[model samples]
Target: MLDLTKLAQQMQGISQQLTLEATATRQRLDRAQLLMAQANERQADLVQMQELWRDRLNFTAAMPLESLDTRIEIAAPPAAHTVIATDGSQIAPSHHEIAYCYLINVGRIILHYGQSKLPLLDSLPEVFYRPEDLYVSRQWGIRTEEWMGYQRTALEAQILAELAQALTDEMEAPTLALTDGSLIYWFLEQLPAEARDRILAPILAAWDQLRAISVPLVGYISASRSGEALNFLRLQSCPYLAPDCMTHCSEVVDRAPCQVLDPLKDAALWAIRLEPGQRSPLWKSSARIQEFYGDHAIHFCYVNVGSEIARVEVPAWVAADEDMLQSALSLVLGQVQKGYGYPVALAEAHNQAVVRGGDRARFFALLEQQMIKAGLRNVGTSYKETRKRGSIA
Candidate 1:
């Protein structure tokens, strides 16, 4: 067992160290602001720099669509609009489980405000026990876990598309469709070109549907650690007249002049400057994968949502159109206000998707019962798993 009592004396020192770090962080943000002010007029130079380094460098930097300080006023959300959201959970197939089975539960939520439409909330649970479901290529022993996350993302987006199409005649159109994380499909980048194409087909199709419907699909990331904005500031701070990180700063990674802002996140740049309900300028993502997005290219902006800074991403079409961007952001602000620092639809969806510990045990028990009913002799757990549940003193 671990005891906290032994470290009582060091607690104050830890607090003091944290305070010092906070002070240092504030100084770093101040430095970045100075760089932003100086770089505002050098937007052309910045863009040129990014294009020059496009394929050679593997860094995430924000590409501003306008002047660095440009911002849009968030209009009031429609008093009567619908918000739909999705979240997913999974029970991974395990060696210790009673069967080689896993579960995917997707939660869907739709809420209509300023209208009497009853909310639609449901969790769709799917069980995968078949050889086809358990493995992508069983001969190579590539289990589902190796690729389930991307599959779930595609599934969630596809469901959102279904919800949008299904509700068109039944109710007023959704003002926004939301999910709780990055929409970039960065996970697929790790796969081979052919594999990525096969896995990404569904997600792209879902995005195409949303694009056709023009219902702004948003990916809301609360307390984001992305350094796109910070990376931009880093480029501005690059000491070379013609900056080339490889040619100049490659040997001096730690001692580079731009490393001053390296410790800070992107949100810190807007935390103090942007008022609640205000947002940072839209910046197109530099991800290589977005090159393939075609109609669904990604752009993001940071919003000051009262309690915390949130990174909000939308498709290129929505981001470029002023009216759609305004509509989506205003509703996002409303959702944050209603939920108190988070989106209400997403919160409800998460509540539906989360699987409890008791649920896990009961799930396995049910699996065992069903296996016995089917006369399956292979439904057995390892001795180690049994010991984990009923440990000895």
Candidate 2:
């Protein structure tokens, strides 16, 4: 039972906070105006800043390092194009359950844009119970959800890449492989090196497989709030004189160069520039994951998807190849138009992968039945769970 009265009281505070933030954001944008105009003038100093703080700063590069103003016109999808997408859902391990287990379900959709054929849809659900699957490290403490979630996400990409590779190998026409987030495995950076490698090795292998197949794989982040580009703009605000990056920005907050645009996101910055189906200039990622990727470093562009500006991520190989880039853009925009401002294949994959409340109840019931048949005592749930369900008989 939700406490609507309490929730309503909380809403007032949220509304007030939003209003204050909005005002601050506008002021920040105003301060950023001069720097935005003088971006070209300040571009030369960014490298020196990077060189100086190469070890100190955690921010990504401030702006486009090369090809600052190249906007390619929107191209139409090929007459015979195939759009493939994959998404995932997961059930975290519950201590109250009879078995200490977790599940990951990946759903994929392959839709032919021009052909009059039915779309191929399938879901692969796996239950993990092995000791290795259930292992939790001292670093994670009691939180295994993050570990399992990362694995599920990585698996989703691997699965999508594998499917894309197999289909691309047989297809004659242009095929676009789409996934629902950044292609770079950014989350693994916080983990210990060995742990990160253990998880990322297979994902990297799958990326290699996709590259070998020569398919255009794109990651679509809808309503992206990524401020990677804006971080570059922040560099423009650094007042430290060129060749002397000695003084850090933190010490001179008021004297810092471009604070006005601090509140704006990359999406907000590009919203005014890009038209529907058009993509903004490509920019390289400065994430730590970039080092691991090397030649396959992640690069991104902003696309106006009619509804909102979406950030699309691709490996360097895809970005460097004009044909592949154009194909990815056209296919993604076409999918968005067909999906009424969202990609239909991704939506379908998500729908297929979702684990509903009813499904969870049934899963627990089945597990209990199996336990009983095995001559085990009934595994009762915790008092908290029982209270939440209000005496389920």
Candidate 3:
């Protein structure tokens, strides 16, 4: 049981600390604007920074932009456009269980605006028990759940592509497909080469399908922490006098410029700059995985949703198309407005995908019954789990 009085006291103390941090954060944001304003004069520094550390750094255009400023005019979406979103939830494998099993639930919602009565909805929950699905890497003894997350991401993209492909008729309204997080599976870098290849191949296929269909699919990241823009600011502080930093600052410690902007999230940085419905200029990602993206390299932009800022990622094709970009921006903003700062389709999908405590309890009960029927050792509940289940009196 929680100590109510103590918990309240701790929360109050946390509130005070948050207030202090918020004040400091505001000051840092002001300083960030001043530093970013000077990015142009430091173009030579960026060039040097790139030349010295091209392999070490990840940048979209090979060279950091001389200016950190880009603003695109927001255009309203068509009244009859459709927005589809998918979200996923997972149950990780437990060692206490007889068999290593986990579940992935994907929920999809298709919302048609402008007098469309039919809104498609579906949810799929898959259980994996195959030897290949149970273990990620036998050599490393890693759990399959670790890699399943990336697989789920790929599955979501594949589902979106399938849905997009199904829309064969050319309607007046454009259809926009959305997923909850980044399009790039950055975690793939953490996996072994074989694991990465196995997981990424299908996602690559999905990307090709979406690109061939020319459908605008977006990966919406809320409160994004990416700092691709800050890399330019860091370049501005390059201390090297020449195009190569190998000799000058190589031995120096923590000399990157714009350390003042450290820990500032991308959404927070754009919150003050963009108006509601307005979008920042497209910024290409410098992720190493993008080398495999072929013509579908990922790019991102920040959108101002009035209540909060959000980072929206799209493929290079969508980024290059003004009509598609505007439609994505407008529909996303509209979705946020309908959901009160979040997308309604995503919210509904999340609601459908959620796994409640009651659901878990029922699942365990069924598992126990199955084990008993099979004449297998019950391996009764863990002592810790038993204690947690009891009520506090």
C-alpha TM-scores of all predictions:
0.94, 0.89, 0.86
Question: How does model 3 score by TM-score?
Answer: 0.86
Report the C-alpha displacement of residue 139, candidate 2, in angstroms: 7.0
List where candidate 3 sits over 4 angstroms from the true fold: 4-20, 41-52, 56-67, 115-117, 169-172, 242-258, 365-388, 391-393
Candidate 3 residue lDDT tens string, 1-393: 678987887887899999999998898789778766776566566666666666654332223322357666677666788887888888777765545678787887878889555887887788776877776466554556676676678778777777777774644477788889888777776777777777778877877887677678888888777877656555655444442445554565874343566666667778888888777766777777777678888888788887877888888889888877788888888888889989888999888777787876676677778878889885467666576668586
Instruction: Indicate the worst ten consecutive residues by lDDT in candidate 2.
Output: 240-249
lDDT of the candidates, in the order given: 0.83, 0.78, 0.73
Candidate 3 structure lDDT: 0.73
RMSD of 1: 1.9
TM-score of structure candidate 1:
0.94
Put down candidate 1 lDDT per residue, 1-393, tens digits, no spaces.
767797887899999999999999989888888988988979888888877885544467878887788766677798899898999998888887777778888899988898888898988888878876777534444457866666677778888888887776765644688999998877666677666776688888988888787888999999898888778777788777756767777787456777778778988888877888888888888887886788788899999999999999999989888888889999999999999889999999988988889878888888889889998886778898989889788
359, model 2: CA deviation in Å? 1.1
